[model samples]
Target chain A: MMRIVKDIMARRELLVMLVIRNLKIRYKDSSLGFLWTLLGPILMILIYAVFLRILRIEVALPVLVTGIFVWQYLAMCLGDSPNAIIGSTNLVKKAAFPRLMLPLSIVLANFINFLFSMVVVVVYVRVAGEPFGQLALLPVALITQVALCLGVSLILSSLNVFFRDVQHVIGLLSMAWFFVTPVIYDASLINKVSANPDTQFWLNFLFHLNPMTGLLALYRSALIGLPAPALYLVIPSVVISGLVCLAGVTVFMKFQGRFADEL
Target chain B: MNSDIAIQVEGVGKRFRLRHAGTRTLKSVALDMLRPGKRTVRDLWALKDISFSVARGKTLGLIGANGAGKSTLLALLAGTMEATEGRIGMCGTISSLLELGAGFHPDLTGRENVFLAGAIMGLTRNQMKKRFDAIVDFADIGQFIDQPVKHYSSGMYVRLGFAVAVEVDPDILLVDEVLAVGDAVFQRKCLKRMAEFRHQNKTMLIISHDLNTIQSVSDEILFLDHGRILGHGTPESVIGQYESFSRGVTTSDLRREWGTREVVLTGAEFFDDGGRETSKFKWGEALNVRLHYEATKPVGPSVFGFALSDENGRVVNGNNTQIEKVEIPGLQGTGSIVLRLPSLNLASGTYLFSFSAHSADHQVNYHRLDHAFAIGVDAGKRFEGVCYLPCEWRLDREGAKP
Candidate 1:
């Protein structure tokens, strides 16, 4: 792992260049261009707010909007990472580099989009007289999310070379994983759904098990001035994301030797 | 591990497990993990036990037929894939033009792709920036550098690709059949650039079927056959073996033909004096060439010709209806043309024959087949030079004897 990091560091310029390329290609031939990055989450938040409203669950718009922006990063990374290696077959087969860059570039590109969306959320909340939450906690949440995302992206991109069906599996898994995370709902609602105390404990435990859980809390705490529930879960999220990241790098390097052949 | 060696390989081999189509999917992989069943996977050793060391500042050329593992070996050296067995130790940085523009994204502008390609080759942004103008200038696609590569012509694309590859300027370069693209002028330019690389003391390993290019540029040649090294030595010696190896098996596999479909040469055969079809002949043996053709269009004043050229592509003898005053007024439907040789006077060497039918004015070729047939002449070193002239040596004792 240290060696891989060193290799990436050595090729950091290429990584940055590829990230720019990812963003450039994403906007190519599209008239809307950068607006789409901001528009996508804004639209998703509105739609989800409408759905939650129809379900008669009252939630703050800032909370739901912030969640959507964060979820978009995860969703975008998942969508693109599976095809990252296969899509850059030309680079993977022709040029020699730390191929870990392929997925890293994708995650970085989406992270940039996520960052763009968050700036708008932060400004609108500030302008609308909504208090800024614990902004210091944002970096911790951001780092945790980036690590988790980097891990998942690495694993998916590497595995996709062996099993092409991995692309579709990522799609289904993202949708299923999205509902369990409080991307649209608040974590406090865990009590309303389950009358049984034992069931509520397990439900809360299940939510925290998602590495996104603690990271999402930080985002909410920092963006909307809401107290982060189960904020201590950040420790487990850190550990799990760390393990997932380690596993991801392991799986990636284990199969990366075969990527040229399999691709 | 000699410091003088730029590239070294020892017992290097790549084995591919040829998996069936059904085994590629997730369901099959899951089933495979569950059952651990014995699957019928064939092992294809693309390269095996290959060992060669190229000295610094030297050029090594690879010659082989298709599927001879030349590309696989180059890919291994380029660090595209690992060798399943043995080791390849490369000194200094390496660059490979395995396929020109291999990583070029069409949606990106040529300038962007140039930088991207440079990055892929391990060049930093500032390094690529310093060399960017040189690359674009070498590519010579004026003003197209700002435009996406998809909008560029194929030649422009190749030029940009070749330009970036060489400009990255690694210590060791691996070129694989990339010089064959672009126009003749650009090819000559590329060869000159490669020669300059040699003068700059950059070691190179080039793979090209064009023996002339390889012969002129390579300091040494490595001949491969079916994943194994058959010969490795000076260009003269290894190319000689490769030529004979190819001549012995010049069955339609080596045929190079291109013509309009108005008329086509469907088949060709070589026959000895006894009417036995054979590719081998004595230096003075009578030989006959028969060409079967199918003409889809009616032709007038058609001239059929065949030229016998030596391995160096020098024509020792050529004949045709126009030259022989036997012009056909028309050629319609299927027919055969025979060029009967009373004596094959070429010296002992491998010769290739090309057949063509064209207008009497040599304006248009109804059909032309080029170097489609290879015939070997056996003279037992009886004579020197290309042609076996009808002359005898006389030992007359008229002389200044010391």
Candidate 2:
């Protein structure tokens, strides 16, 4: 691990160049260019808000909008990470660098997009007259989210090498995860599901297993000034992130031999 | 091994398992994991037990027929893939031109792709900045350098690719048939640069079927066949072995062809006057081309000619049976005809003999082997070009125009 970090440090110029390439290629020929990054979340939030209004949930619009915007950024990064290695097979096979840097670059690149979307959240907070005290907690939540994302991205990109279908499966899984993570609805609605015993247990179990639960809790606390979620959810998210990251790196190294062959 | 040996390979091998097409999907992967069924696995060994060491300042040529595992071995040496069971020790910075434009982006401008390719080759941005002008200059695509590569001609593409690969001054360079795309002039320039690298004590491994170029550039040659090193020695020795292996090859050697004349050549073989089937022939040795031609009808002036060409398709000898004999005698038969050669004075190479049985009026070709048989010319005495000519030379330097 230290060797890889040191290698990346020495090749930091290439890393930055790769990141710049990723950024440029993303918006190279498009007329709208970087605006699409912000436009994507804004459009999604508007569409979801209209849907929620139709359902007559009567929930706070600001909270729902903030949740969707933040969740979209994480979702895009997670979805793209799985295909990062496969997409950059040209670079991976030809270039000699720390192989781990490909996914790390994706993580960093997506984090930039995540930072861009944060502007929308801040706007919502000011309009809703929420105190900025919760904003202090946003950074911790964002860090945890980044960690969780980095870990998951590493696993998916590595696994995609062996089982190419992992990219497609990741796409489907992220969409499914978005619905279950309380991105549009609050988890306190656990009471609504508690009306049914089976629904309540699954709901409770999902809150603990889903890393997005931590991010949603953090976003809620920051935007609506709600208290940070139960310590139980927080602890597991950290442990899961750490373990998945370890598993990702180990699996990636083991299969790194096969990447050039398969690619 | 020399003290400055820059590349070493010991028993390096690569194994690949061919999976069924149905198992390509993720659902199939999951189902196969659960069932654990016995699946038919075909193992392809791309390189096996290959061992060689290249000293600095020397270029080793890798030459072989198609599917001879040449590219796979190059990839293994380039650190693109690991040896399955053995080790490869590489010293100093190594860069490879495995495929022309392998690192290029179609959407980016040629200038942008140059930097991207340089970075991919492990060059810092500043290093690339310093060398960028030299690369663009070497590529020689003036205004097109700023345009996307998609707009450039094929020659421009290969020139740019070759330029970036050699510009970094890598200690060890691995080139794989990438120069075959450029024009002859640029190819000469590339060869000049490679020669300079050789003079500067850099090691190079090049894979090419162009024996002439390989012979001129490489000091040593490693001839590979079926994933193993068949022969490895000086360029003359290895190229000699490769030429023999390629000559008098069977019908399976039909790589690709042109000119459809319905001439399904069943077999082609060469032999000496004593009637012994062989491919190896000494210079100016007695040789005979026995071609088994099957004709549907008796066509007039059905010319059966054989032209021995160099690897680049330049003719050395082109003569027809009609020319040798006054009458080819009309053929309505499904039998065989033998065309004999009195002397084979062609230089050593894998020469292609393309036969064409055309009308005397140059109207229709009854039987045509566009590029059928390949013969090997053993080393002896000959000029270094397509054909060998008997000419007398006198010392006229004192009386020359100069």
Candidate 3:
């Protein structure tokens, strides 16, 4: 592990360059350029807002906007993670460096997009007249979200080299995961669903089981004036994310030697 | 792990698992699981028990045919792939040019790619900036440096890549046939630069199928055949073995006997002055090329000739009875033709002999055997150029100085 860390540090410049290169390529041919970073989340938010207003849903727009944008960041990371190593087979075959940089660069590039779309969340909060008291916790929330995304990205990218179906599976899985999380809806809805004695156990168990459920709630609490979740909920989500990140790094390092052949 | 050694390999090997089924998809994977005893997996050793060490300042050339594990060995040395067994030890930084434009992004400008490629080669941003102009000047693509690399010509792409690679000043350089690209002039320039690197006493491991390049640059040569070292020694001996190995492979595929069989060249041999059959000859020594032929039916009026080609399959020189204006009557039985040279003036390298029997009118060929035998020439003295010309040097003094 120490050697891996040192190797990554030695090639940190390459990691940074790869991230910048990916960002440039992502926006190179597009006319809107960096604005395209927010285009997906903005469009999703607009459609969800119009539909919710038409249905007379009383969910807070600021909460939904922040949740949707963060979820978009996660979705893009997960979707692109599988190709991070496989797509760079040319580099993998020719150059020798820490393979961890590939997936980490993808995660960092998506983090940049996530940070860019945070501007939209700020505007929504200002327009909605939400108090900015808890905004100071935004950095912590963003860090945890990025950690969770990176861990998952690492796992998927490494596995995708062996099983190419991981990418396709992730596409469907992310959608289901998004629906289960409180991205467009409120955490209070899951609470209301858990109010029944017959379904309470399973619903609460699933709500706490998903790392993103706690992360999305935390993001809402930070961006809007939503009440913070219970310590038990927050602690388990943070711990699970950390554990997954550790496991992801371990598994990624273990399989990285075979990446060139598999790719 | 001797300090004088730049690289050490101890019984290193790489194995790849070949899957018979396309297990990439979930459906295929499930199907693979259902077929339990189908033998869907097989092991392939891309490299096996390879062991060699390169000194700190020596240039080692690796020569092998395609799929002979040359690239796999290079990748293993570059640390891109790990050996399944044994170990590889290296000292100092290594920069490998396994492919000319391996990490170049087409959307980026040439200048941007230089920095990016340099970084990928383990150069810091500051180091790249310091050497950026030198790399650009070396690449010599002036205006195109600012243009997107996608629009650049392939030559320009390779130039920029080679430029950045050589400028990195790695302690140990690994190159794999990257010099095979670019035009002739650029190739000469790259070779000159590589020579300069060698002069600086940097250790280099190069893989190339071009025998000339390998012979010229390598202080020692390693010939790999089927993932194992077939021969390793001085460039001359190893290259001789490689040539023989290659010829043996193609000889099986060639039509050994053709042409109506009216007259056939039954056998051929080369004898030295002692009249003993020998393929190895010294420079400026007598060599007798004897060809034995047989006539199935009474046929005659034929000319026997042979061509001496260098190792690269370039015909150097040959002579025929018709060309020499020698007349021969019709023959009715087996006979031999002796073409003797009192002094063979070839340089120190391997030469191939090919024999052909043709009619005196030069209309019909009776039998032709190409690359039939290989002869090795060892020049006792250091001689430059392809063939040695016996000459005496003379000097005239214009003014007398005590």
The number of the candidate with the highest DockQ is 3
**Fnat for every candidate:** 0.77, 0.54, 0.83
Q: How close is candidate 3 to the true structure, as a TM-score?
A: 0.82
Report the backbone clash tally of model 1: 0
DockQ of every candidate structure = 0.61, 0.49, 0.65
CAPRI grade, predicted model 1? medium
Maximum-lDDT candidate? 1
Q: Write the per-residue lDDT of candidate 3 for residues A173-226, one digit (tens) a residue.
A: 888998888888888787675467658656765687788888877777887878
* Candidate 2 segments exceeding 4 Å error: A195-206, B27-37, B248-279, B282-284, B287-342, B345-375, B378-402
The CAPRI-style docking tier of model 2 reads medium
| Model 1 regions more than 4 Å off | A195-199, B30-40, B251-342, B345-402
Give the per-residue lDDT digits (tens) of candidate 2, residues A132-182. 556776777777777777778888888887777777677778889887787
| Reference-based lDDT, residue A153, model 3 | 91
In model 3, the Cα lDDT at residue B35 comes to: 94
> Higher TM-score: candidate 2 or 3?
3
Runs of candidate 3 with Cα error greater than 4 angstroms are A54-57, A197-202, B20-24, B27-32, B255-275, B279-402
* Root-mean-square deviation of Cα positions for candidate 2 versus the true structure, in angstroms: 7.5
- Measured with C-alpha atoms, the lDDT of residue B1 in candidate 3 is 85
